[model samples]
Target chain A: MEGFIIALFVCMVLALISKYLSIPAIPFYILAGVILGKAGLGVVHSDEISRFFSEMGLLFLLFFMGLELKLERIIANPSKVLKGGFIGLTIDMGIGFIAAYLLGFSLMESFIVGAAFYITSTAIVITSLIENRKLMFKETETIIWVTIFEDIVLIVILALLSASDQNLLFFFAKIALALVFMYGISYYGKEFLVSILDRDDELPILFTFAAVLTTASFALFLGIPETLMVIALGAALATTDPDAFEQHARPFKDVFLVLFFVFFGITIDFSGGINWFIIAVICSLAIVSKLISGMIIGLTIHGSALSGLEIWSNTISRGEFSIALAVLYGSPVIATTIAALVIVTSIVGSFTAKYSTWLRRGIVSRSRKKALMHRPH
Target chain B: MTLRSLNLPGVGTKYEFETDKGDTVAIFFTKTGIIQMYTLQKGCKTPSAAEMSPVEARRLGNILTGAIIEADQESVEIAFSALADLRITIHTFFVTPAVVGKTIEELQIRAKTGTTVIAVCRHDRNIINPPPTFAFEKGDAALVIGESDQIKTFEREIMVN
Candidate 1:
């Protein structure tokens, strides 16, 4: 208990410092875990209890995301949502899976690797957009919708993939059932829950937390990934009222999230045979794969070469989501590789964002001048 | 022709005129501070009468006519007139250096004025009908509602220039 408390304190301190310093907090949290973990000072041990609770951090995080989602907005822009989601996921996952396969990973390992790579960190993307004051721009809105769609697709894919080995038809049937259940919960169950919540003037935070946990556990029982189930619950709530859920769950989310990072940091074995070559290969793959995928999606959608490049550059930054996926799957190599890639890509992405406007302006000006030159005057 | 010769919506006068393509105009009342404006262009569809209230159409029409007359060098055709009324209420007050940390209610009482605090603007977020217990922070834009004379005095007394 003492060690856990100490580790938590250290992780919080690191996270606070990193937040102010404009550094991504995930790496610091992971570092904190390593320092206190068995691999370092051994102040904290990697135990199943800690792991189980810490995993809830991801669930709450997704739930929080769902609260913000509005299905109407997606329905309004179906073409962009569907095309961008399908293309972006396919390119990122396909290339990543191929790379992992080439690196001698088993099919399952490659599949997990692909899944990890395919998901762009929503926190990182949204934060960057807000910071840049580009959140209101048309292109940014498009990107946001695409990212949201990708997240939804990921939740479904993760759930299905994590289900026990079954025939294709069985898997399809399970997916259909999950969708129907989600719809029912969203339409009917949500209103019932909200009314109950409204009547209870002194509703304890534990009740809400327990409800989410129980739902996730129930999902696991039904052969669904807990992460997917949690996210689905969140998405359903999002269809109703986000503000209430945000108000209720925010405090608990913050507490467990800190533990989640500490646990993640503790799992990193820095000194246990560092493979520099493998790290380098993974880092390179991360950059190339995302860049190619983003560029392809941008070009395909906008039909503008310049916009495609800009899109490619912007999508490169990876952070918490990538790390969380790695940790969830218990792949240390994947985690470390993703961590290194995030650092590299954030630097590159920041630089790209800084100059993308200028590049876009130049391209537009050149095109205009060329058009004028071609004029009959 | 005199200005009164033109049949304006408010003035109850009807005048026939032609407007050039891609011409924009704005009409507004100098007294009430209401303004309405739109563009007259080829291949542009006008909003339906049902979409706009009678008063709004009149205001919008006047503004459009005024804009067209102002840009008389361009040809324009004016038929039935309508206006787009943009009502802007000046919900303004000042943040005094002295009353920095006090709650809004306490400040309202201490200030000894009937200036109703309508809203508080903190950074990008706007809090409307903020609670009495809501403490005032430095650099907050407090939107007050009251009689014009009282508001002016309140602004002068409380708001820092």
Candidate 2:
């Protein structure tokens, strides 16, 4: 209890600092975990209560992801989403995977590293776009689509990683059956579900809580992974009343997700000698890979490299989902590497997102000056 | 003017159109009911944007449509007194897809809500006491007189599907 209280207090302080600076609180929370946990001062340990809260945090985060997934919207604009999504996947994930493989990590660790590298921080990206008032720009739309695409791909990655050792066919069939059954219930009970969601009392929240808990517990009972089931449940519920579900579940997600990040930070072991060279290389590549993909997407979709620069500037951060991947599936070295990546990229992303317009303007004027100098007067 | 709408995925729908001044105006209607309007002029490097609450947007809409004209409180009260005595008021509803292409007879507005269509205001002209067979067109504003509850009924039944 004392340790938990201390951890939360330190996190609260860090959260305040991050908020005051108008930057992301994610990397700060993880840093607090590192400082307080065994890696630094050794003040906090992973107790049962903290562990449970952390798990809730991860589950709610995934559930929130499911709620936000609007498949129809993605389908309606498949061209842009696919074009931007594939460009990002090939370049970002490809570079991340290859880089990690050459750095002496195992195959699975490399895949984890690659995925963490590939998935940019959606919260950081979206929040900064709104803050920077860049939403009106053409490239903003492409950036959003790519994030949505990464989210969909992350779900697949999580499922594959979780069920890697299971009998592949049976695992897939079971998940498929569960998803179909959930979808059928949501479809047939759409009216009933909406009616319940529209209620102004406690039932709506209770129902949401009960639905998530029941799904989690049931998945555990059936020996299926709870993460995928909760996400499936969320997606099914989304077909009914996603906004309402989000409203009711947001409080739980907010509190629990903080614990999830901090606990993840706490568990990251740096006892093995730190690989500074590899970490530096991976961090640099994380930024460069986004630049390459952002340029490609911008040129193909928006017809301008400056717009690509804007996209890369806003998307340089690897945040919550990356850390979630590390905590869920990474080895100690992988976790440490990802923590460093998130901390560095997110801080850098905040500044770049803020000043990207100035950067673009600088480049434009510089090019124009060169053009003028080369011309005969 | 034709409005081009683009889906902004997680944000909202963006409706853009070029004005007579050759400036492109994009209005974003977010799912959370916030409205953002951006105007980009030719040769301008950055667009000018403004954010508004849904209520503010509606008030601006009323002004744009000339529904709420600039009148002092006393003058507005005097104008309302003419209809206040009989508990009757006027409501102006723009023609929506649900009511467009339907004749006054088909809508049975009088029978359904005990309201009378006093006038139909189109872009160029206003028609007083339109005939029963008069078919409504898009962008036409029907000015009807009725009690408050009857006006609500008309809005519920006819103005929207």
Candidate 3:
């Protein structure tokens, strides 16, 4: 507990540094964690308390994604959601598997690795997008919807992976039950919940936290993914009054999501236990694979490479989710390797978004120039 | 170098500032003092966005493209440093038959005080630099420009008690 508090204090100091320098703090917080954890100074351990905060962070991240994408919209566009979500996962996982297989890992290990690589870090990508003011871009909607779909698939896999004893069939059965449960509560129970809570500011926030706790606890009891369950809770409330829920729930979500990134950093083993060179080569390919996948997805929807670039630019970073997968599924070597990949990819992905505007303009102008040169004077 | 007005029908009046750096920004100014900014993506329009504060709005307004805001020269932004400098302030005195029959030259307002009445808002119309022959009506609002003290004194002398 003391170690966690000191770690929080360390994050605060790094945050101040980031502010003074006028840079985003997502990367800095992770770097700070690495420096403070056993990876560097051995100052802060990923204690049980920190682990709890980390899990809360994922729950809140997905929950807000639920808030933004809203339940009605998600249900309305099932085909669009599934297609957009499938593109990035299919590409990254394919790359992850092939890379792992070529590196002589077994089929199961390869599948685990591919699944882990399939997820883009919601925390880092969403945080960077908002901070850089790229949240208003035309492609932002396309990017977010795709990510929401990815997270939905991710949680299902997480549920399956976490409960090793349960077969996929049982998980699917539970999911069907959960969906029915979600539909009933969101459609029928919304008004009652809102009336019970009223418009009290603090209680709405408390209720949001309670909602997370109750659903997360139930998910554990049911052998389902807690991440998916909290998202369900948020979706239920979103179906009621999205604005009120957003106003109440955002602050709690923000604080914990920061802890999620830091906890991700603390878990990395920068010591010789991890193989850096092999992971670096493999991760670079994964990043390229993500971009190619995004481009394909964008093309399929918008019928233009430029639109594809939009999806690619926003969806390239694979952070906390990949790290979560690594910890759960990877052998010790692979898990540590993935941790390194998360840090590198997040930095690369965010910087891509940071300068995406410049890139877009340059490409547009160059294309125009080429067209002009070909035209008769 | 040039400002393009992208005043969409449903959207707010948007002004694009094309910079020498080749990057452009679209600022959507609403009726209320709210500013919505976009990165001006080439092929995309109407991106769902966030709002910036009035201070930022003003800064963006000033720096982006030269918007000649007539009243913003000695604006509150520079009002403290430009304290002694000439300032433009509109003092709308509610006239109840007070100097209702008066004309500008007859009033000798400029000769008596350093304040200049730049325009008059009568009902829905604005008559800028109203001719000396122009008569002041019951509800005429005078837009004056002068030093701070001069403006106050001019208001006091002309406004009905």
Could you say which candidate leads in lDDT? 2
In order, candidate lDDTs are 0.64, 0.87, 0.70
Please report the TM-score between candidate 2 and the true structure: 0.81
What tens-digit string does per-residue lDDT give for candidate 1 at A303-327? Answer: 7666576666567666666666777
Interface RMSD of 1: 18.1
What tens-digit string does per-residue lDDT give for candidate 3 at A1-377?
77788878888888888767544577677777777777878878887788888888777776775665554556877787777778776777889888888787788777777877778876556555555665445466567667777767776676656667768688878967986887688789888767756766567778778877888888889878776667666666667776666666678777887787787777767554656667887778877887798789878887878878877777777776676677557776676667667767777787787777778789999999999999998
List where candidate 3 sits over 4 angstroms from the true fold: A19-24, A69-71, A78-83, A126-138, A167-183, A196-198, A270-272, A327-331, A361-377, B1-35, B39-51, B54-161
Clashing pairs in 3: none
Q: State the local distance difference test value for candidate 2.
A: 0.87
Best DockQ among the predictions, by candidate number = 2
Off by over 4 Å in 2: B29-35, B53-161
Please tell me what DockQ candidate 3 reaches.
0.10
Number of the predicted model whose TM-score against the real structure is largest:
2
Worst 10 residues of 2 chain A by lDDT: A126-135
Looking at model 3, how many pairs of residues clash? Answer: 0
Per-residue lDDT tens digits for candidate 1, residues B78-120, read 3333434432223454477776888877766426655677778
| Candidate 3 C-alpha lDDT tens digits along B1-161 | 67887432112356767667665675666423466787654445434455787887765655544323444232122233466654444444444476688888887888877777788889979999888888888776677776657766776776546
Evaluate candidate 3 by giving its C-alpha RMSD to the native, one decimal: 10.9
Q: On a 0 to 1 TM-score scale, where does candidate 1 land against the true structure?
A: 0.66
